[model samples]
Target: MIDDKTTPCPFLGEMVVMFCQAYPVRKPVPKHLITASNPCAGKGYKGCPFFKDIMAGLGGATGVDPTLASRDRKGVTS
Candidate 1:
């Protein structure tokens, strides 16, 4: 779940919390967000909350990218 390594994700805290709740078995760390091998190893996940949470829980077991489950809204395009 490593982000791009450019900047820290604003949603990192929320994402980690959600991830822990969703997948109590595999508690991911902030390091995962920068490892490139984790499931949600990208950016823009900071926006899509649900998808991001799901991916964190899945932990690469699912090929689902949180960014793709995005829904369009006014001023919001992914």
Candidate 2:
């Protein structure tokens, strides 16, 4: 259940939590968002609060910049 408080994905135009549903499994992160292959790689689970929290921690879908989020995974920043 998405609410106004939910952040919309800047790329997909859907709620960040809904990203798991729309994307299902992880795919190659878009080049505009990331500069590496499989930068945002991960398996997605429906109705998983952990996934939601991760997305939120990454600044929600709307606020997230894949490049920046990838830093958390790779321990690198640009």
Candidate 3:
């Protein structure tokens, strides 16, 4: 079962450690937050700069923005 706190960033290519695919590295980089668990594995994922950049570049994927759907899933009121 999925944990409520583990929102998982879409740019997170792998689950064996917080490997992020938002960078230009040959392989996804392992990320973390010394202050807490990585945001890539939590609701704070929406705050990632890379996530925003990638989502912005995907304008043509669909007329509707994906964040709206995410918010609905998490019951976030915009």
Candidate 4:
């Protein structure tokens, strides 16, 4: 299996960008709707933009989720 942290990082970055571009409104995506499954298993935590912002808010790297900085601290999977 891929390290959980590394697996989701790229998807999270893309989500961050998508979320920022579509920000100012909250769009709730049902867990089933998301499709980044191979690496993330469609877990909102893996591909959900909200999580990216949350990770960023916790004094992490400005854009990408910091847990992705390595194969550690992947934290909770959606």
Best by lDDT: 3
Which whole-number lDDT from 0 to 100 does residue 46 have in model 1?
47
What is the alpha-carbon lDDT for the whole of candidate 1?
Answer: 0.47
lDDT of candidate 1 over 2-64, digit per residue (tens): 668887787765443223233325454655355554445546434455555656555644666
Q: Would you give me the overall lDDT of model 3?
A: 0.54
Candidate 2's C-alpha runs over 4 A off are: 1-44, 62-71, 74-78
lDDT of 4 at 17: 21
Residue range 10-77, candidate 2, lDDT tens digits: 68653222122223454444345532333234333324564566677666786665445645654333
Q: Note the Cα lDDT for every prediction shown.
A: 0.47, 0.47, 0.54, 0.45
Lowest summed lDDT over 10 consecutive residues: which window, candidate 3? 69-78
1-76, model 3: which lDDT tens digit per residue? 7775878776866543334444434353344332357676767876888767656666635455555544443323
Error of 1 at 37 (Å): 31
Cα RMSDs, all models: 15.0, 17.5, 14.3, 16.3
Cα-based lDDT at residue 51, candidate 1:
55
Highest-scoring model, TM-score: 3
TM-score of each: 0.20, 0.25, 0.41, 0.23
